[model samples]
Target: MIRKVFSDTGALAKAIDGFVPRQPQTDMAIAVDAAIRDQGQLVVEAGTGTGKTYAYLAPVLLSGKKAIISTGSKNLQEQLYHRDLPLMKSALGYTGTTALLKGRVNYLCPERLERQISECHRPDSEPGQLSQLVKIREWSSYTESGDLSECDALAEDSPLIPVVTSTNDNCLGKDCPSYEDCYVVKARRRAMDADVVVVNHHLFLADVAIKETGFGELIPEADVMVFDEAHQLPDIASQYFGQSLSSRQLQDVAKDIHIAYRTELRDTRQLEKVADRLSQAAMDMRLVMGEPGYRGNWRELQTSPSVEKELVRLSDALDLAHDVVKLSLGRSQLLDAAFDRITLFKARLARLKDTSITGYSYWYECTRHHFSLNITPLSVADRFREQMAEQGGAWIFTSATLAVEGDFAHFNHRLGIDAKQQMTLESPFDYPNQARLCVPRHVPETNSFRRANKLAALLGPVIERNQGRCFFLCTSHQMVRELSALFREQLSLPVLMQGEMPKQRLLAEYLSLGNALLVATGAFWEGIDVRGQALSCVIIDKLPFASPDDPLLKARIEDCKLQGGDPFAQVQIPEAVITLKQGVGRLIRDQQDFGALVICDNRLVTRAYGATFLRSLPAIPRTRDLHHIDDFLSGSDTDSNTMQSHLLDQPIEG
Candidate 1:
């Protein structure tokens, strides 16, 4: 049945335009169908252009069963729910309801909106916040889903978002006057009744954590669970399974307490004093942590005299606020919410104070104005396995880059999945003809002081020749800034940096500028699709290796060594291989897409592990000459084609 649905003259090809039959897609569909029928575990690596979304969706839709589909990000969740899933449902003629369920923060909370509007009317309110609130209030009258992404008037990075959304710590749950009209409650109720539900990884992990505590769950139980972009599960699961307390959370609780004192319990003078002290204490901790935008070793910092003193001060301030809020909890719903938040914060702080625990990373990160102390477990394998057993459903994990060097050992070890079936389906794109790979001569060492300048000098002409449809991917933010600055100085095209705006806006601006170069790190490496000639080249600064100073990586390294394993081979290289594959996968998104890849790290040729990275990439034509990049991209030099064909015949090696 699954194969017939994906065939050349099937229902999908007849109903959907540009629907060509793909064997890889059909194979994946059959595998998913069997997994769902048998209630088994499966892992699939469906490469780019394999149409994995429809491959899994068709089987799940045709099965006539309840399912939960989770993606890696909110954007993908929205895309699947709003775009892909609808198209598949229509083409396959599957009549079953589906719901797009996101975290509570994505929905507009009427209670929070009302409180913010009331607060905005105060004389000391910010100048533009009230007008923003007024615009959102007007939109709220007609918007059914209350998803804030639909509010065109609200900026993506607006300060008003946190003021107008509900978190677990701040939500009044069933006790508020607006509970009957709550958007979150309505969304969850719909999700409970829907045949299929779409969610993101964070929300799925949150549901798991909540369920473990015997509390209610956000996501409904289903007969099957499909995790798309499953490569990110281990890292995200660690966060949910561990404990964390951040300055933003602390300050948010403090603000709520002050609000309760002002509007709900005006006579509680002690509430006001303790709120101020708590806020100040949180700020003092950030100050004592020194500079921002860096992670610190909390294990070492805990014993320092200055940090220890501030920790005690912050604990005392929290205790004082908790006592004051406790005295008047029943007097105000807001006060009661604050009391619960303080209690949670106290418990988390007490857990974070314990540095004697094994198999966890004790770390703290500081932004410009906020800080977070976290304890993440080195591995989430056991917890994740236990959750799957409890859920008792067919489990399927699929991603473009899940398998490193044609093996799933690292990923399986991290998540403790012993899948009953596994498959690696290559993308059907004509990569040897569509893409060219370059590891140019005289590449600078990664640690060279003049690396950025030399790279600019070498790649500037090639980028200019291609007329600036390039992405200079980097391994670090500092590298992003450095290369972006150099390209701006050397090239005439518009240079866009990542942090300048939101990611979608940045991509829109890149497309709008037609011939622009985007320099980015992290998020840009994956989940970004720019088909056609708008994005033609991707130049990576170095191999995408996690920093040695990273706390999580450090913990994993220690744990691997303790288990008598080679940490670099088993942990670091495989991880970097997957990341490099993602960065390269960004170049060719469609069958018709053509591009050039330039990897600037000499380690590929100088180090033995380089073969692992090379063999993991697609079968792109490789070259070492800069002129070949311009020639291949422009189709100017016929000899370059011959060179490409010859290189394509050779096996990838160090």
Candidate 2:
């Protein structure tokens, strides 16, 4: 049955978007089906052009199993839930259901909206804050899922956002007044009954680590869990397994206390005083930390006395405030929510007070608006393994880059997986003919101070020849910011950076612009899918290594060294290979996709460790000459034109 479906995947591809099918995609479907049938673990390295979404979805839906499909980004989750699942359902002629569920924070809380609106009538209300609140109230009437993404006008970092969404600490669940009409409850109810469910990695990891009572438990319902971008799992799991507190979290706590107090408390003056004290303490904490993103682990932080004193005051204020608020007169949903939030906040502070967890690294990340205290585990392998065993399901982990030198040991060691059952699905795209890896003849070290201007001068003609159709990726945000300034000065094309706009809006603009260039950091390297002519070349700046001085990486390396292991090769090289492969995967998204990958760092050609990075890539042709690079780009231009014309002839599908 699975073979028949794979053979007929051509029809599935055409049903939704006029997509062309590839043999690798079909073979992957077969392997995934076996994993599901046998109820075992499977790790697959599906290359860029493998059509992974449909390949996995077809088998899962066809099997009629309650499967959880987790993607790496919101964009991919939305696409799979809204775009690919419907097509897979249609082509397989199945009538079962599908649902999309994000974390609790993604959905709006009806209780929050009511309390916020009532508090808006106070004399101290900001001029336009109420209007934005009203706008959200109006939008909520027709919003189905209550997911914030439906509100196109709302900025993600808006002050008004906390007024609408509920955090884990504040969510009252069944105790909420609007429990019957709650969006999160309704969405999860649908997911519990649906044949297939889609979620991002955050929600999946949150469910694994948190296991909060009342609403946030997600486990054992599905027989199998498919992790789409499994390379990102280790990093995400580390964060979720740890604890973090931000100014945003503290501010939300204060705001909720106000809403609850105004509605119920007799002595609102004392409530107001305590709330203001906590808010001021949070601000002072930020002020004491002078620079943005000034990071230091707890051991290093002990040397600073002023910051430590402020943190102690903040914790005491929260403790006193929680006591004062609970002695209120009336009871409402807001009161219950505020009480829970206070309890949770105090517990989190208690966790942050300790820096002696044997296998954890405690640190703080400071910014302009707030400072975040983090306690991240040095190794999440054991914790993740326990979560996996507790969940008790067949696990399938797939990504474009999971293996190094055709070995999955590094990935397995980090995630605590023994991948005796594994598959490597190579791209069916003709990489040797369609793609070329190029290194400039006179590439300089990325560390050189003059390299910024030198790189722009060298790549200006390359971008011009390709008509400004390029993606230049770098290892750090500072480097990208510098290159963006340099390129805008030298190049005539429209240049865009990551932070200039929202990620999706920027990507939409990049698509609309006929030929444009982008210089971005690691965030753009993966989970971005752009096909056809517009994205024909990807240029990387360095070997993408983590600095040994970085707090978390340093702690991790120390642990590795203490265990008598080679930290550079064991931990660093494999991690870099995974990142470099993600950047290179941007080009050649499809079979007709022809492009060149240019590396401006000469280490890939001159250093001995270069072979590891090279072997991690697909079997694409390579060169170290300027002439060969030009020839490949020229050929790509011709192929892109022909492919665009062909697409115009095909029947368009939405």
Candidate 3:
């Protein structure tokens, strides 16, 4: 029956305009159906070209089950809800409704937006700000859902955004003036009534956190949970389980108070003064911390006496802001929200200041425009397991990359999942025939110009031969900048760097310019799909490894050691393997796609641990010869397309 659902005349196939069925997709559909029927847990690693989305969605629609489809990327969420779901419902002729729901921060709080527009219209408001407000106000009128995505002109992190958007701590639920037409309420109601709800991991984890607290809920009644990109769930879950306070939050609070004080029923002068002080405190806190960079663990920062004194002043200013906002709480819901936010912010800061708390780690991070302090739990497996037990639903976890080396032990243990069944489905693409692996013999360190030039020599010919259809992925931003500069100085092709434009725009340019060498870092590593000749080669600077000095990485390492485990073999190596796999996965997106994956770091051929990274990749031909790589990219290597390689079947856990 599951196979029939994907047949040529089946509803899923008929609903889609140009649908083709594959054996792996049908197999996945069968597995999902069985998992749902048994009310058990499943860990499935499906390779690219498996049509995993439809494999899961077809069963979900056919079963008439109330399911929550959680994805890692918002772009994917929108794609599913807007395109995939509608096509399935229409083709299958299903009666169930589907809804797209994102985190609270994604939607515009109308009550807050109206107040902002009203203030922006005043004579004292800057012309530029008022102009932006008028444009937004115009958009809000016709935007049926009031989603921020409708206003493409406004950047997500714009100062104007905090003026209109509301967070979990500041939303005026049913007491707001726009209660009747609240977009969030309407969206939630749709999800509650629908058979399937689509949500990103952040919103899904938020709902879990909210339900655990016994608060008023938004998670609909669901019997099954379908997780796409499940590899990221465990890492993202840690964020929601922990607590953090950022300069952005404080800035938002101060901005809200300033806007609210203009019309509150109290003496506006004192409140305005207090609001300015609060904003100043937030700014001063970031200033005293450092000059636009991460200053890990507050303990390291406390040695600077001036930083300590500024922190004290920030605390005092918070106290004053909270007291003033409390006095104006009854004036309006906005003021009430400001008061609540101030109180919560102060409490979080207090907890962060307390060093006696066990089972947790604290750190401070600063950037050019913002700073943050986080109190993160050492581990969240127990809490995650508890939630899983409480939910008592059939959980289906699927991703392209999940296993370390044909084994799911690392993934299962990290998420505290006891899987009833598991499977690994390899991609149908002919890797040995379709692609080549090239690793130069001489590894170039970052600091050496001779090495950079040598590295450029190794890559420049490949790019020129391939007509500039390549991606240079690095582990660090500094590396990206450095490589981009070198490329601009040497090779002449339409060079596009990551931060030069928005991701979508950059991708568009890359697609349009058939021969373009795009230099990027982590953002382009995954979640990007460019098939055919547009992206024929991927060059990675080094193994994609998280910096050990990073606070989060340090905390995770300590957490594993406390449990009597090797952090490198258990944590660091596995992470790097998975990330390298993601970068390599970009090569074989379609059956017809062909590309070369190049790693300049000779570690893969020289170091003992390189075997682990090599095993995580598909069993493909490998070579240290650059001539074969050049011949392959030039499409002239006709002598037996497959090169022999000593491929390992397992990760070297030692």
Candidate 4:
């Protein structure tokens, strides 16, 4: 028998209010608790001021059911596991076991570490590679968490991850000599016994994908799963359900083979032969991928003879690697290590070749020093639903931008949830009294790319009106750069661009400057907070739209078309609506937060779809004139009537 604590939403809210310090956080706690206790699916849209994290956590901790909380980024994962959980646990007076599970790449492998140390002593090694290996040796003894995140000296793009980490296709499982001491296996075991596990979305999707392939599972059974940043689910799911291979992986294979030969080699010449084949395969792949530049969809480039030739060479290299590994199968322990490496490489190549791209989109991406081929499933709704059913767990998907206008069709359909069970919770933060939506009238709808210059001119007066504590959000980097340069020359305020420094550091500088204008692109539009007077104005250059020509977007649209669905209505519109809401939401982050939103995009007033975007916004006082916005900011008398009169003076274009 379960002990019933709080009954309805009201009772739960009161209980939370009495315990937790913040009022809005208490409300979130109640909703989360009531939903979990009833074993129902929930969709919540909490605003920036709602204290969402504590609200969800309180109910989860008190319910006594095993819960898994999935976040969107690794940074957030660390925050939850290292900072928030311990504080919340103590404040709520609850005692429960909790564990943080990350992707396998985060942990150190003792076997791989020994091999790296051995290779560092070679005569041809890079100048600083030996010193870095020595540092790793010293750090390994004192590192209790076994997480690679603590190592600041290692670059994220280093060759270490593939060598030290295990992927599903690469892991030797219990057969490995170091299986008993494996960090990845140990972490999974700890998660199984804990009451709550914190994992990122990528890891969660990978576990789901592995389950589909009949591999061992990563996450343990849970009664409930709460996806914190629910908006990123679709894109993340596409990655897991897709196929990808990189030139870097092939190069790593060659390096590992060379290192393995130094330890155990009955025939050094054969090992050299395998290394040469692997190197040639990497070079062939690079040549086929062309010069290091953006190569869009794979279908467009699939007909190239060079690509075809390299694919054959890669397959042949894998076969040769298999033969060499087979020759040293059960001999020395080091030979066994070489066999494991070769077997993993062979299996990965086979998976890449045979992986079905029937219901998915395929693309090739090239960077400065790497080339990767990617295949992403257009939709993972059915797969997600099947996973939910198998787990037999209730889910609560919550984000500030889950609904569009008053409908949940896009979010619900994308996740394959029943519409009848979905609910939209509006922000408790007062909007009309605290915020104003200003649409500049002089902006043009011309399709010319030079409209960016016109946009900068329109933004100048609005920035002046708000005294320069502003966030100018753009849809692309090119626009951001152009507008930033214009703002620096035209406006007297200090102008900051996104790429000048790290995002967090830049945000800190902006806040410290107190009246600086920061112009940035997509990443800064959402999941950012600037309350009080630090952010009194927000200028959006245009409606956020997914590029139709983007490889991933094209693939997704094509997949939807094949399924007899309207890709624009199903995918693009809702995604943009959600993203716009996030950008607008940055303006008023607290109850005391007051600001003006100036959207330079003329389509918001000229297009029929503009109503959809408008309805999704907060019910703030709105205007489409420059003078009224100036008056409102200047503390003049401007009520709903004044806004209406100004709008009536000019004909409504749409």
Candidate 5:
């Protein structure tokens, strides 16, 4: 039945435009179907163009089982829920219900919206905030999902988001005045009743680790859990399993207390003073944390005189706020919530103060006006395994880049998965003929000063020749900024930087321009799907090795060393290989898609570890000559056949 669904004459072929039958998609569908039937564990790496989405969706819609499908990002979640699922439902004629659920922050809280609007009357409200709130109020009358993404007036990173939305920390839950009309509650209820609930990894991990009373019941109730982009599970799980306290969290509580005193409990004047002191303490703590964008060793920083003093003051402020709010707790629901938050803050501060614990990365990061103290466990394997056992259902993990050099050992070890079935299906694209892999002959050293300028000068012509249909992917944000500036100076086509605009808008601009270059880091490395001629070239600045200064990576390295293992070989190399493969996968997304992959770093040819990266990537024909790259992109390579034979027999070596 699954095979026929993915066949040339299948329902999918009729419903989905340009659907082609591929053996790998059929095999993956069969594997997923069996896993669902037996309630077993399975891991499969379905390469790009393998139709993995339809492969899994076909069985899921047919099975009549309650399933939770989690993707890597909310963008993908929206796409799956809004676009792919509808197509699949029509194709298979399945009648089961479906719902798209996200973290609370995505939904509009009627209580918050009302509170914020009432507060907007204050003379000191941020400029333009009122108008934005007014726009939201107008949209709220008819919006069904109450998803902020649907509100066209609001931007993704607007400061008003926190003002109008609720978090786990601030949500009043059953105590909220607007409980019946709460968008979050309504969304969760729909998810509970739906046969298929779509979510993202962050929400899935939150459910696993938090298990909060009312909001965390969705994942555990499902019979099957499918994690797409499963490569990102370990890092995400680490964050949820760990603990964190942010200055914004503190400031939020203080703001709530102030609002409560102003509107609900006018007699409690002490609440005003306490809230001001608490907010001041948080700002003072951030001030003492030194420059922004700094990730420091929390254990060391806590001992510094200034930080120590601020910590004491912050604790005192919290205690004082708790005492003040305690007197008027019953008078205001908002004050009661604030009181609970103060107590939770006290507990979290006490826990963060303890640095003697081993097997955890005690670290802190400071932004321009905020700071966050965090402690992440060095290993989440055991915890993840325990959750899987407790949930006890068909657990399926799939991604295009899960295996390193045809081995899943690194991935399995990180997540502690002992799957009964594992498979790696290569992408169906004709990579060798359709793609060109080039490590230019005269690339700058990875560590050189002004390396960004050098790379821009070197690859600028190639990008120009391709008419700016390129993605300049870098390992660091600093590099992204530098390259964007340089490209804007050198190239004539549209140059879009990641932070200049919202991500979706940026991508839309790229597509509409038809000849634009996008320079980005981190988020753009994976989960970005741009097919056809819109994206034809991907230039990577360096091998994406995790910085040695990363606190989590540092902690894991120490643990590996203590266990008598080579941390560099065991941890770092495999990770870099996986990341490199993902970046390379950005090219050649379709059978007719042709592009050039240029790695600006020479280590790919000069270092021994480079072979691992080479082996893990798709079999794209390699070349070092700039002329060959230009010819490949222009369809004029006279030596195309010879170059393929030569490069396939023996790739360029140092």
Candidate 6:
């Protein structure tokens, strides 16, 4: 290991010098540098204030190895590529090229845009659509990035994405007229040649799921694969392996059918009939699934024989549309457009039939007025293992909560990594001095889920004491709504609920409000930062446990049970530990951040397995007395040692 003080003038040393290390961050950086330099795998759990980004980046940039950093969200991806990576490169004096690669749908296709504009100008089109189409034409001329994100008129969930972009399933490949000028292909090519590629877990898993060559395809094999926010990989993998066909795909087919065969029907009457049938089929499916609502697991809602019959009828109409286009293949642009749409629709329908249920689960979902059938694989360990073996690179999976009480068995097993090589580095943050963990002394565990009134009654005093800069993180929307209503009635603070506004906007409002209390679901538990005095308390309503009845969870637990493992111990416990850590982490985001973490779930104090959860947290001063929390928040000079002693006196449940 290269040992040097914080002031060494070398590139990596200078970057380290600028970074203020709170013991944990410096130790983690040294460990990561050692692991990378020695060509080995290491898992480090650096706490919230540890500045893990610089710890990992220092070694990654200095090692001069082609690295692929996968983050949990697009927001994080942009943050790294645009902000962190550039800053680190400048600080370290490294001149390596890097590229940010997003999914294909984000980019624009000139061919599809031209076709849409051409169709809009036809005499039969509605005036409103023609006007919108004209705007797209003007924007398409000078847009160099070809990214739809730059277009304000386009909504992220718009059906226009599929119409104007390409997917692996429907991409015309080299056969298309715009193949040479494809934006997606261009971005991907850039990723292949770059020294470091930044991507989200979704795109990374998509590559793993679809590309089987194991080498020399889209992403070049790298020397190391660093999963920055490694905790989200499993859930993201579940999404990619799942199957879903959207109503938008069907609707697009209907529009293309009209475009292709409209010329053949001189009477315009027959053209309207085909369009109406396709539209009706889509509407019926939407009605069945409830358009604009996110419904999971469509198996519960049975489709009658009539609905199935209509699908067949729609499929036949699509076939007829395809045949018409095939006949006019060499003749007109209109027929060609219809042919492409018909082909995409048929392919999507075929995928639904071929959807695998043995190792995965399927569901029908509707979001933003679009309906889709989704299928997700139960376990991705086997697939991830294959990638690891094929890539044969040094892999480092680190997170604030990868282990429960120093055990990496659960996370390692899920990701198919060897547990023997694992290492756990606790956050060097002075949690015991700077923070406190509070579990309300007595709360009934038996009726907790059902008795919302009682739960809210217990939460009232705690909220009152904190003076509203609290995040009431609940496990379900039902709890969030119930608590928000109760808190609003009892508390004097401005109470904001999750669904009141978009999450990012809501967080912004919450911070701006200064002393407002926010009731939110699991979305606010992690990947949220409320620095300074804005957030002073984090109240967890219950232990974060995966629903036992959830299909994905059930499948994973069953698989674990079959392998002679205790599903709760091996899976549920570790999963909850990581999640609870995320919730507790929200309170102390910065070194100056001092707050209280109150978990109202009595199970943490009464259950035999509770010690595992407690051990996973930082050595914080804990208390069961509501008065101590009141005194601490009130700026009273309470003895910190007394609080620590009180926590130690509590019986270790296990």
TM-score of each: 0.97, 0.92, 0.94, 0.85, 0.97, 0.86
TM-score, candidate 6, is: 0.86
Q: What's the lDDT for candidate 6?
A: 0.73
Q: Mark the regions of model 4 whose C-alpha exceeds 4 Å error after superposition.
A: 1-31, 151-182, 211-220, 287-295, 331-357, 444-446, 460-469, 484-517, 626-654
Q: What TM-score does prediction 4 earn?
A: 0.85
Per-residue lDDT tens digits of candidate 6, residues 1-654?
A: 223423344454565444443456667777777777666777877777667887788788888888888888877888888888997888777788898888877888777677677777788766676666566667777886677877877765565667777555445566677877877777878878888888888888887776621213645568877888798877887776565667777676566556545544444455456666766777676765554645555444435565466567667766665665575575545445556766767776666655444666656666666687766776778877877777776788888878888877777777777622566666656686677788876654735446567767876787777778889898888788988998889888899999878787798899888878899987888889788778887888789998665656776777788889898988888899999998888988877777888887777777778888988888888887767777777768356887866683377432
Q: Is candidate 1 or candidate 2 better by TM-score?
A: 1
Better of 5 and 6 by lDDT: 5
* Ordering by lDDT: 5, 1, 3, 2, 4, 6
TM-score: model 2 vs. ground truth: 0.92
Report lDDT per candidate.
Answer: 0.89, 0.79, 0.80, 0.74, 0.89, 0.73
Candidate 1 per-residue lDDT, tens place, 1-654, comes to 888898988978987888899999999999999999998899999999999999999999999999999999998999999999989899888899999888888889898888878887879988988888999999999999999999999988878889899898889988998999988888888888899999899988987875531123534369899999999998899999888999999999998888878787778799989999999999999999978879878998889899999999999999998888888968989889889999999999999999898989999999999999999989899999988887777999999999987899899999989898999999999887888888887778899987999999999988988999999999989888888999999999899999999999999999999999999999999999999999999999999889999888898999999999999999999999999999999999998898899999877866778888888899887877778888888977545356564352245443
Give the Å error, residue 211, model 6. 3.1
Tens digits of per-residue lDDT for model 5, 1-654: 998888889898898788889999999999999999999889999999998888899898899999999999998899999999999999899889999999889988889899999998999987788888999999999999999999998888888899998988888989998999988899989998999999999988887888762546777788999999999999999999999999999999999998998888888789999999999999999999988877888998999999999999999999999888898878889888888889999999999999998989999999999999999999999999998898898999999999998899999999989998999999998886788888888889999889988898988999999998999999988898999999999999999998888887888999999999999997788878899999989999989999888887899999999999999888999999889988988887878788888888777777778888888998878877777888888888745475775362365644
lDDT of 4: 0.74
Better of 3 and 6 by lDDT: 3
Off by over 4 Å in 1: 212-220, 638-641, 644-654
Error (Å) of candidate 2 at residue 28 is 2.1
Which stretch of 10 consecutive residues in model 5 shows the poorest summed lDDT?
645-654
lDDT of 3: 0.80
**What is the per-residue lDDT of model 4 for residues 336-427, given as tens digits with 9 covering 90 to 100?**
65566666666655665553547767778887678887777777889888777676666888788888886777887777765235555566
